[model samples]
Structures are given as C-alpha cells and as structure tokens.
Target chain A: MNSNGTTLRRIVLAGFVLLVTTGVRADGDASPIYGVRMPEGYRNWQLIAPAQEAAPLNELRAVLGNDIAMKAYRAGTLPFPDGSVLAKLAWKHVQSPEFEPASIPGAATTVQFMVKDSKKYAATGGWGFARFIDGKPADEAQHQTCLACHQARVKDHDLVFTRYAP
Target chain B: MNSNGTTLRRIVLAGFVLLVTTGVRADGDASPIYGVRMPEGYRNWQLIAPAQEAAPLNELRAVLGNDIAMKAYRAGTLPFPDGSVLAKLAWKHVQSPEFEPASIPGAATTVQFMVKDSKKYAATGGWGFARFIDGKPADEAQHQTCLACHQARVKDHDLVFTRYAP
Candidate 1:
C-alpha cells in the first residue's frame, strides 16, 4: 500500500510540473485590443526562436487520433519606457481537414498587428487572404492580406494582435 | 560657423535619439517575432481577451490612411516555464476611409500556420471570405474569389503569416 501511494504521488507531482511548464490555460483575460507598431525601438525585448519540434510531430500524431487541427503563434509583451504601454500579437492557423501539408505547401491565413501604448492595437500587417494557395515570404504586396482582415479591430489599439502571457 | 556647427550636432543627436527610442535602424533589424507557450500547471491556454486584435496593422494603416480606422490597445505576454514558450495577443478596432470603425465582424480570411513548422504558412482558414457591401464586413464566402488571389505567394513562409517589424 505504501508503494502504491508513493507511485500515485509521483504521478501527481509530475503532472503538476508539466502543467506549470506548459502554461496551458484555457482562460484568458479580456483586454481591449491594442495597435501594432511596426517593430519600433527603445522597448526592452526578446524573440522566441520558432518552434519546429511539434511541427511534424503533430502531423504524425494526427494518425493516432491526436489530430488537433488548430495551431497558434503568439508573441509576448514589450514594456515601453513610459510603463503605461504594452504590446503583443497572436496568430492562429487551422488546416482544411482534407488538405495535406506536403500537397498544400502554405497556410490559408495570416493575422498580425500594430499595437500602440497598450490601450489600443491595430492589425497592421500579415497575409489574411489565401485559400488553397500558399504564400511565400518573398511576396510582399500579396502578404498585405493580413492587414485587410485585421482592419476590423483598429479602434481599440490598432492591435489585431494579443498577448497570452498574462 | 560655430552656430551652424552646433545646429548640425543637435540635429544629429536628435536623429540618433529617435532611432534608439523607436527601435528603428537604418539597417532595419529592430522588429523581432516571438513564439507563445504555457507555464507549468496550466491545462490549455487559449486567447480570450481583445477578441479581435489578431491581424496585422501596417497594411491597414496604408489602406485606411489616417481615416481613424483604428488605434492601439492593452498588450502583454504569456509564457510557459517548461518549454520557455510565450504567446502574445492584442486587440484593435479597424475603421474605414470614412474614419469609422470597421462595421465588419471577425476576420475575412483564415489565419495560416507554417505546415509542421517548415518555414511555410498559408491562409487555409476562411478569414478572407468577405465583401464590403456598403462599407461593412460582409461575408463573401460564396464568391470563392479569395483562393485564386493568394496562389502567388507559395514559396515564402508557405503562404503563412509573417511579421515585418523592420
């Protein structure tokens, strides 16, 4: 009985650690949208190296009934010197259930933003116009589609982007 | 001559300060894009606030052209301790040339993700399917006009969204 109890405790501890590490919370606070300023200056910052680990892993996992069709890219906060302003951006992706990455070659949407002094943010740029076709980084004018979609959330902060860090 | 030299020095100093404070550089390397993740002990984190600040901003600025289309908003970051991943989200109200908030709701095109993290992204989602009938966000999903337009950017980021902060 003692041995079993020990095993159960270990499992619980591991799960707690995992949760803490993942930062996977479904509840997010409701903040007014902010505007995105094209990468500006004088703000303290850091860039999260793009994650390639879960990319293919997700694809393979799909076959095992782990086919989570949605994925998101989120940027963290920038503390402006004024201390009153903060900024963030988040992008989400959902694949057509029938489409294959190898065959499709690109995303169907791109969302972005221009967040100003935290109070407001705007969807400044990113491609949000594409269906079956793929988009490339080399394509500039076409990439403007992202801003077109974000045009709806400008009043609050010029931000169509957001922060999940809390 | 002394007066002229002093003026020139002041101008140069102002320019330098602007560059540093704004995070802009003649070489264009200030904007950095970061990824989002969860901290330990969280179940599943998803965006909840600023329901609409998930798109780009610069492009909107160009299209709206000071029309008061939108502004910026509250911003912050989210992080997961284990993976060191962070996600950012913000919100904004996109307006029109009439200087009114976009009457449209939600994104017109689908937000895209790089397939399996292979440096490719596309707008496979239905975010681009809209029509501005009488200057409001109207659903244009029936037109199927978005896909053909997005086909050109297949090589860069796989039609996925990218942040051009430079």
Candidate 2:
C-alpha cells in the first residue's frame, strides 16, 4: 500500500515538472509566489523564542492540543487532511515510538514537510526508528539522529525544543 | 512567566558552556539518562524518502504531520525547546508564508509549511509585521533570509523538505 502511494507521488511530480516546462505563460501567471500580497499587521511580528522554563505539559498541550493526540491514540490511527502513506507513517510514529505492532500498527517509514515561519522559513521532519521492539532502552543513535532533523533549531528553541506558549 | 523562563534557560546554557569549557567529566560516576544500551536491529532501521510522485494532498498531509510544525500550530505560540531564538524565528517564517496571521487571534503574521510533495502547511500563528496586518506583501528579503537555518536540512531531507516517516 505504501509503495503504491510512492509510485503515485512520482507520477504527480513528473506531471508538475511537465506542466511548469510546457505551460503557456499569461501576463499575470509569471508573478512570483513570494510576491503575493499578505494580510495587515503581518510585518509587525518578530520571531521570539519560546521560554525554556515553560512547563513541558503546557508545551505539549499547546503543540499537540491535548485533545488531538489523546484522540488519535485512542483510535489507533491519526488521520490528516490528505490521504497518504506519509500521514499513516507519522501517525504510527506518534502513536508508538517503539514501532511494535501493539505500539503502532500499519506503520510505514517515510514522511516529508517544509516549514515556513514569519520572515524566515525552515524545513524538517524525519524517519522514526527503534533499535528493538521490546528493548529496555531505545538507542541513543536513533534518538539523536531523530533530533538531527531539528538540530539547526538549537539556536532557536534550544535544539528543536519549542515552548508551547499558548 | 514566559520572560522568567527565558532568563532561566539563558543561565542554564551559560552553565553548560562553563562546564564544557572546564572539561568537567563525570569520571565514571555518571549514568546515561536512559541507561545506555546498544540494540541489535539498529541497522535494520533505515531511512527512506517519501515518494517523489505524491499528490498535493499527500504532501500537505505530510507537512501537517510534522512534529515541530504541528506543535507550534496547535499551540498558537512559538515553543522553543532548544532555546534558540533564531530557530524560533526560522519557524515563524516557515509556518506562515503570507507573513500574516489569519487563523490565530492576536497573531500578527502567518507561517507556512510545505512538504516535499509540495503540499502547503500554511498557518496563522502569533507575531508579525504591522504592514502584514494591514494586508500587504512582505519583501523578498524577508522570505529569502530564511535559507540559512533551512540549509542545514539540505542533506537529510532536501533543502525545502523534511521526513515524518513513522
């Protein structure tokens, strides 16, 4: 099922490339996406780091919304706006980090995303891994490597740790 | 509360720097946080990129599932785990492409997250420029400056993409 999705994605990217290459350019069609007008008060904002001392629980709540994570856990699957294997994979990773059947059934191994923030933008998201199904402790390499995705964020949120300031 | 927390994090970081500079070692008295142990299946867990042909919806789902992006979106604030203001700033840029916040009340700007599949992860989080609030476009400089933080992700997930594989 996952592989099929991958195939589909490849086809779509190919189509987009073709479209961009072969498209007829209207006068207005060439406008840069970056130049699109934004709503009012957008520039008044500056990126401020969330405080580190914020309660982890509050942080978690602000990000995941206590309701969403718990509901997904209870249901055994987390659905997204789009129907894709990536969604299933991310859902499984969050449902159970260990990658056990009981931990996260129907787990896949790929996900992707790009993040945009105020004036600057950053991209991250990555594979979830567990060295053993029932191991006493998850390996450091796996965990740290997972963190490597957000390492650039260290200067921002202290190594990808964000304050769930509500 | 938030300001105080930020101050504490600064102190902790300073102390860590001090310890590292002094070369303070545990001298065999320290224990691993999770009790270090190497596991057998470490090699079995491999990283896989998402399908290149994924549809727009698939890409969107992937972006929405991003742990970092989603957490910030759901919480309606910048959560900084690593205590880096730069990262938080980068996040804001990635979270909202429009440079304005529409979904979040009191928010001054917006951020957008796009998956490797080219799906949009746009959200209106707090903080932004005043011009954006009045509904105008941000300059290219603001959008272009985000590459430094995002560049770090180039090797792992492509410059503009990240993985959320479960």
Candidate 3:
C-alpha cells in the first residue's frame, strides 16, 4: 500500500490465503451439552476487543460480536439480551520477521463462542458456550469447563470477558 | 472477566461509554470536491488491521472496511472495486496504569476515508478521500493533499493500504 501501507493495528495479509492454517471443517458441528453450533459468518463480525495470552498459550486473539451483541455493547447494556453472541478467535503469536516488537496471528488454535438464550441456557447464567479446534467441536467435557471458568471469573458482567474496544 | 479480564487488543474502557472522546458532530457534512460524507453506522465496520504511529503522531489506529470492502479483502481483490470504502480510525496512544506493557487508545485524533466510485472519482484512481476531525471535514487545501500522498505510496495496491487481518 505504500509507506502508509505500513499501517492497521499493521496490514500483514499475504495475498488470498484467509483464516487459520488448519481450517478445514470436519463436518461435525455443535458442542455436545450446550448444542451451540458455530455461528454463521462469525469471521465477518465486528470486534469487541483484542486480547493476548501469556505463558503457555502466548496467543493473540480478538472477540467479535454479532449484530445484536454489538447493539447491546454500543448501548452499554449490562445484562445482555436473548440474542447476544460472542466469538473469540485465537491464534498462536509469532515473532514478526520484519518488525521486532510486532506479533502476528499465526496458526489459529481455536474458535470459541458464547451464546445468550435466557431460557435456553439458564444453568449457565443465560449463556451457552462452545469451543472448536480446526472447525470441529471439542469434547463435551471441554465445554463443561466454559461455564465454570466464566462463573469463577466475570460472573458480574454477564460472563463476557471482552469490553468494547474503541 | 476474571484474570482473563485482562484480555482484547487489552479491555480499557472504564465503563459503558463507547467510541471517540470528541465524538460530537456538527451540521456540516461531506468533503467539498468528493461530496463524500461520514458513512452511516461505520463504528460497526470490521477491522482490516491495526497500526501504530511513531514520534509526533504516537497513535494507535485501525482500518475498518464496510461489507463491500470486506468482500474485496476476503477475496484478495487488488484495486478494490468501485463500491469499496475504507475507514481509518485514529486515536492517541496512552499508557495503561494497570499494566505497564499495555497502551490504550486515548484522545481521538482523526477519522479518514477512501471511498471508491469509478465514474465519480476517475481523476483520483476511482477513489475519493476525506479527513475529519471531531466529525468536521478539513479544509479544501487539506483535501487536495490526499491524492498526492496516496499516489506517492500505495498507488499500486489500488491506493488501499490495509490487508484483512484474520
């Protein structure tokens, strides 16, 4: 793009290769207990915020929200409504060959989702959770830990870890 | 969100407030020659990439693309199509008191755009550019420089600088 091409939170896409490196769906869908399927068009969703993980994970991630979720976020609605959906896309952080300080999303590790359906998921505080690796749903036991993690942590903010990033 | 609460490109919004610090807009709209105006519902655009400025600018900026722009990006379409539009949202970078390593978007700087209209902006490579501060367009002299700047740099990438950050 030019010197300014050096620009976007920096533009590093190398041509048409899109999404994660190991991104072929295995035809399996939906987490076992919660039955939450991967959201449609989740990749096109707007960002709620960017996040980084430390130590073993050492990942770069972003949380994205569906339209209803975004509307709630923009309005600062504390208790999200029935249709709220959040997707967390995570990739292993890799050192940039070109820039020393920058780390790019490399080898996507997971795609997780949090869906809100007050009556549908009352056991998990009005939310349903799912995690996928290589587009395949992880084990039910893996999903079982999602609510436990959210409850132990941000039970106050409706189990959403991401705040809207301006 | 618990310790994970420390997550998103890190969560810095103090509360429910969203968007730029100086977000209020006046009656005047659209740049003079291009007649390009602030896009409706642009805050919801998807992120293309994130960029940082050095020295005097010291800013954190992200480029956003509307549906058309996103399609072009996802498809790796060089010389973005006639309907493509890119929005660059800039903010001054400020230190985070809680985390020494993290910096957050501080004061609002400027919002700039490159709008594509093949027939309308034929002179500027089918793209019309606009810059706004506090929702007001800069002077015509300032507008005149947009083409010259882009031409000197990323004229090769259809004058677009961002790549879709997966």
Candidate 4:
C-alpha cells in the first residue's frame, strides 16, 4: 500500500479509539429522546425563568435556552421554532442563616434538556425531554413520564411550561 | 409626654434613620422611576436570560424575575401580571486568558428593574423602569429614554424583551 494510504488507515484507527474511550454519540442516536447528549455551551444560554418547588421535590430550578429559542421568544412565535433547545439545572434549596429568609442553592440535583425537532420528535409533541442525574442519563421509566406530563398539562403551549418573560 | 409615648417616638425615629442610611425607599416614592429601590433577595430570583452586547455597548447581562413573573411565564400569560418585577444586572464583559474563548465578568456597570403596577404606572404601559449605576439613580433624562425605547421596539411584549427559557 502507498504511504498516504497507510497514514489514512492510522487516522481512522485513532478516531475509532477516541470515540470508544469517550463513549459519546450524536444527540438522540444513543437512547432516542431519553438520552440526548447535553448541548454545548448550554450554560451560557438565555435564562428563561427560575423556580422553587415544595415538598417531595424541594429544588431550585433555572431554565435556559439557546439562540433559536430566544429568537422565537422575542418574536412571540408559538410552538417554538425547530432547532430550539432548553436546559434546566436544579439544585437542592436550602436556607441561608446569614441572610435570613433568603434561600440559597445547596447541592446540584440534575441537569435536563428539552430539544425540539418537529420531524424527529413528532410522536412526542415535537419535543424530546431528557434528564441527567449526576451527569448520567435517567432511567427509562422516568423518561417516559416526561412526555405524558407535558402532553396532559401544557399541550396547548407546545408541551412547554415556560413563556418568554418579556 | 408619657414614658411609653417617648419610647414609641424613639423607635419610629430610629426606623426612619435606618431607611435613609440604607438608601432604601418604597418603589415610586423617591424620584418617579429612577430611584425605585432594589428589591431584597433579588439575586435569588429565577434567571430570565443572559445577554452579551458588542462594540460601543460591551456588557454581559443577566435578567432575573420574581415569582409572580415566573408564574405568568409558565402560564404563557401576556402583559406579565401585576407585581411582576424583573431585574437586569450588567457587567463589563472581559476575556479570560486562562480560559480562552470564555468570557468573564469585570466591573459591574448597572442594575436595573422593571416593576409592573397597572394603576401606578398607567401612563407607561403598566411597567415602571429604573436604572442605577454605582448604587445611584441614573439621570432623569436617561431614565426617560428607557420607556421610549421599549415602547417603540417591544410594545407588543409589554415593553420587555427577555423571555422565559423553559
């Protein structure tokens, strides 16, 4: 074989090794909607809102969105445009003794994402929901409930609960 | 005066002094919208969005809203409900050499608020806007332009721009 061909074969072998070691795949390729890979730079996205839930789910949540989502929000577009993505980061809510009555974040609980692709997630209201606990994909049972809850509660709003704070 | 009445007067006087020294005032009591006091525990509010502007106006912005605003957002309500307050904190955006391609906050530029009160700010589309630089209210002329800009560009969005990223 030619020297160039040998070099090409080596590059291909190295690429395969890297992929196997990292265990990363394109979003949605690994586990349908439940295991969508976390989007790059999601932490820097636009903030949609913050939330605090009580009782069984005592957590503080922050919702953020990508540029596509922000554009739809600014335009007041409904059903969100394709390519829109949202991330939710939650932490255990705790009281701050120094600043009485003020709540502060304790430990991080989960990081989740809701990706939109009309064609890919058409069966699930054009949105794919995912939750990662400690950076690991949540169980299948937990993922199944995501679609059901959104469909039942916020079907009219494109299966989304957040609105543009604008 | 009786002893009890004298003690009561002293307490009232002390309370007034505390308020003045802290530079805190009830919203709208000071200088129209320019001197509206910063709300307590605002940093804990839900983040509505993050922004980066370039050139003549280089800054990083974080938009946060109180519970009332978050509720309205989740429900997809328009005109945000009464008592929905949003704060925008901005800082000079600077590049961190240690973390290339990442931006870090430098000096804080301003903290601003958009307070909603249909009856109180009826002339300004039910929202009052205020900006403080270095903890001091911006000039009245600069404050006046805030409403005008929002009114002209995002009037349909209740004169606001940030959206909930659910």
Query: Whose DockQ is greatest here?
Result: 3
What TM-score does each of the candidates earn? Answer: 0.19, 0.20, 0.66, 0.49
lDDT of 2 by residue, A43-82 (tens): 1111112111112211101112122222333354422111
Candidate 4 residue-wise lDDT, A1-166, digit = tens: 6999999999989878865643334343333444577776676566665545455666556677887887787787888988889888877656543323334456778888888888878888888788888767888888888888778767877878765432
- What interface RMSD does candidate 4 have? 17.3
B1-166: candidate 4 lDDT, tens digit per residue = 6999999999989988977654345443333453467776565566665554445666556678888997787788997888898988776656533324334456778888888888878888998788878766777888878887777767777888766533
Model 1 spans > 4 angstroms off: A1-48, A53-166, B17-23, B28-166
Native-to-model Cα distance after best TM-score fit, residue B15 in candidate 3, in Å: 39
Where in model 2 is the C-alpha error above 4 Å? A1-53, A56-58, A62-166, B1-106, B113-136, B160-166
Model 3 CAPRI rating: incorrect
In every candidate, how many clashes are there? Answer: 150, 72, 12, 9
The best candidate by lDDT is 3
Instruction: For model 2, give the TM-score of chain B.
Output: 0.23
Residue-level lDDT of model 2, residues B1-166, one tens digit each, is 9999999999989978865643323221211221111211211112211111112211111112223343433354323221111111111112322212211112323222222211111121111111111223234455444444445434332333333222
Measured over the true interface residues after superposition, the C-alpha RMSD of each candidate is 15.5, 17.9, 4.6, 17.3
**Per-residue C-alpha lDDT of model 3 across residues A27-49, encoded as one tens digit per residue:** 45879898877876788888776
Better structure of 2 and 4 per DockQ: 4
CAPRI tier of model 4: incorrect
- Candidate 4 global CA lDDT score: 0.70
Between candidates 1 and 3, name the one with more favorable TM-score: 3
Model 1: per-residue Cα lDDT over B3-89, one tens digit each:
999999999999888755432243321111212111221212221211222224311110110001011111211110111111222
